[model samples]
Target: MSAEHLDDIGARLAAARARVAAAEHDAHRAPGSARLLLATKTVPLDGVRSALLADAAARAGDPAAPAPVLVGENRVQELVAKAPHLADLAPEVHLIGPLQSNKVNQALGVAGCVETVDSVALAERLATRCAASGRVLDVLVQVNVSGEETKHGAHPDAAVRTALDVAALDGLRLRGFMTVGARSSDPARVRAGYRLLREIRDEVRDSGEPGAEGAIELSMGMSGDLELAVAEGATIVRVGSAVFGARPL
Candidate 1:
């Protein structure tokens, strides 16, 4: 609620937007072609609101500014807690964290989209819940391009098969792929992961699998490697720390 805190968030959001804009231009993407899904994992609800307000204010003056349409959370608990109250901002709340079959109902209750769908079982669970609710949910299949054991996604080789499977589910709209780059200081390594994601997305799109028509989005990158991701044809970057400052320890 502090004015100073809100100002800090506004400034941070403005800077993040500038970086995304610059990256988009260098990548030769059309204006407003990409978006920054503020990864509001540990960020407070007020911080998210302030960032959206700042974006709205900027767009009110310049219509070309990148519109912030999504705010991502890592857990269903936080999403359910904040999504209803922040409906005014109109941003699609997404689950960017690992989703368990048991949490599908809770996640579907609040999330407009689930970006970290890593398994067929989870996808089917979501499809069932959506069917009961009479709603179709947008979902991005997560791929572990880095092959990290700790990451939650299908292996790179299995990504297309997984996406095709998920697409066939009636209640889930297959929206492309998402991945986490290797945690490394070498930019080349990170870019490789993003590149792999784009390649996979293209393969799936070309396969003409049942519901792969609109699987063009590549939800890659973060604060540390966003530019590299953009250079690799990322359509959406999940930036958090840069926009909201470091998370609380």
Candidate 2:
């Protein structure tokens, strides 16, 4: 990255940290805590390195400050390319992208948790891999909460069924549901989208078919409107630009 790009990266990282801190303070604390995932899809390797370095520096100064929580990658290949650079950075690495059946093994190699377990085929693959590795994995049912025709999530009507199948597998723990809120800036639509995800999470818990005990976590919201999601019951917020600034094209 050019020096100018690096400077921009630093400023964006600082702003993101500030916003996350503010969000943490605004919401009523829930249970042990809410998870804040740093969406790092478009951030180049240099920027990621810079951000990680900054996180360490911040922690050295104030232990209470978060160290960019969990980092998520939308693509397995991108994550694989960047994984070595991030090996010592974050403890929890999430694959928030759509999972192709053929790529499940690659995702398993890098992602600590695959957040978009949308299909039974993919879930079964993950179950097999984790089983062979003698490890249990965490996953969320990605629901098409926005009802967008172009979105890659499972249809809202089918999400719970898929979640049931995924959870019943021996290797996967059905953590909860995740959704991308409607993109419109209109607050009402975003809230409604988040509410829909929450509603499904509640229904699945009530049905008791997912085979998980304890409260489910709703992983919704991004940098744009995470506060509203928290208001509606988001247990994990996936934020990117609000933390890292505009994505690098």
Candidate 3:
């Protein structure tokens, strides 16, 4: 790794540690709640390898260990490329990017959680793959709360229906709802979007569906808005650059 890359990772790690500390001190929060899933999309395997090694070293002597490292990827190719070894290192491997029906089999090969189930066709494909594999795949419905055309998630109002449909699939477990907030300098919009997704999750829960417990996860956050996400009941935060450094060109 370049010296500059090391510096970038050091700074990001410090920031993540700081965020954890703040989250711990936030007494208004639940006793045991919310989790971080560092988004590793577009990041090389080496970067995650380095960060996990460092984290393990730092916690060697501590009695209360830090949370287990969780990794997320945004694309099928990347997940396929880096998952074999990482499967043992990371407790969870989430597919936090857009997924298509054609890629379900590949996704099933590596993913522990598919966090961006946005369509009926893709959901059915995932279930079929899971059934064939004799595995019950966990999944999250991606909600486009911001209504951005460029975004890949479904609209917030449609998230529940989509999630329930996926839950009904033979071998799929509707694990939760996830979303990527609109980018902004103020951060309020992003924060609001996180809250909105959380509220949507609760609504789905209150529906008394069979998959409610399995689908309680609300994954909404990245490096920039993770704090806001945690504050607003984000069970999974997919932080990329903030935990890992800038991607190599």
Candidate 4:
């Protein structure tokens, strides 16, 4: 890797950290209440490892750095390919892309959490596979708050019901809800999408559904709108380009 490339990555991570800090401060959230998940899709394994190393070094002096969490990947193949090479790092990997039924086992092989579960069928498959392995899988129901036909998430109106059903399944833990913001520069539009997810999260928490009453995570926001997401009560932010520069073509 070129020194310039790594430097670019470092600069991006520093900027991302600054944004997270500023957002947390503005929200009056306790330090580290929100966490950043470095999105690694399309970024090479070496790049991923370098980013983690940089992330660790950046917070080495700060005892209050955010809690340990997984790096997010959009493809199962990427997770499976890079997982062993990055094993010593012990990075928790979360699948943030839409998951197909055929890929459930492959995803479970590496990911600790599935943040883009859009349907009950996919959730049940994940639960069954986890049950067979005698392990529980953490998951977030993805809601299409943007209502864009291109998005892969349950509609907001149907999200609660879907979440309730997913929560009832065995061997799967419903951690919270996740959504992608509108693909616009407008902060108001982006905030609206995140706010919808938070609203759904609040409703699910009080819905008496199993696994819903506990601390439900809101995994919204991305490289572009994470600040807005934090202001809207996002617990986990999936940041990509901002931290890794643009993905390799």
Q: Write the per-residue lDDT of candidate 4 for residues 1-249, one digit (tens) a residue.
A: 577787778778878878988999999998787888988889877778888888778778888777754599898888889999989888888999988888888999899999998999888888888999999998999999988889989998899999999998899988999988898878898898898889999999988867788637999888878889999999998888887677667
Q: Answer with 2 or 4, whichever has the higher lDDT.
A: 4
Against the reference, the lDDT scores of all candidates come to 0.87, 0.78, 0.77, 0.87
Candidate 2 TM-score versus the reference: 0.87
Q: Tell how far residue 8 is off in model 1, in angstroms.
A: 1.4
Report, for all candidates in order, the number of backbone clashes.
Answer: 0, 0, 2, 1
Q: Residue 40 CA error for candidate 1 (Å)? A: 1.0
For model 3, give the RMSD to the true fold. Answer: 2.2
Model 3 segments more than 4 A misplaced: 7-11, 30-32, 61-63, 87-90
| Native-referenced Cα lDDT, model 2 | 0.78
As a whole number from 0 to 100, the lDDT of residue 7 in candidate 4 is 71
lDDT of 2 by residue, 1-249 (tens): 677766676566667556545665676653325567778897788777776676566667665655346778998899899998778765478899898888878888888878888888888989998999998888988888888887778898898788888879998888888888887979999899888888888888888664754328888888788778877887788877765667656
The candidate, 1 or 4, that scores higher on TM-score is: 1
For model 4, which pairs clash?
Answer: 70-92
Which number leads on TM-score? 1
Q: Count backbone clashes in candidate 1.
A: 0
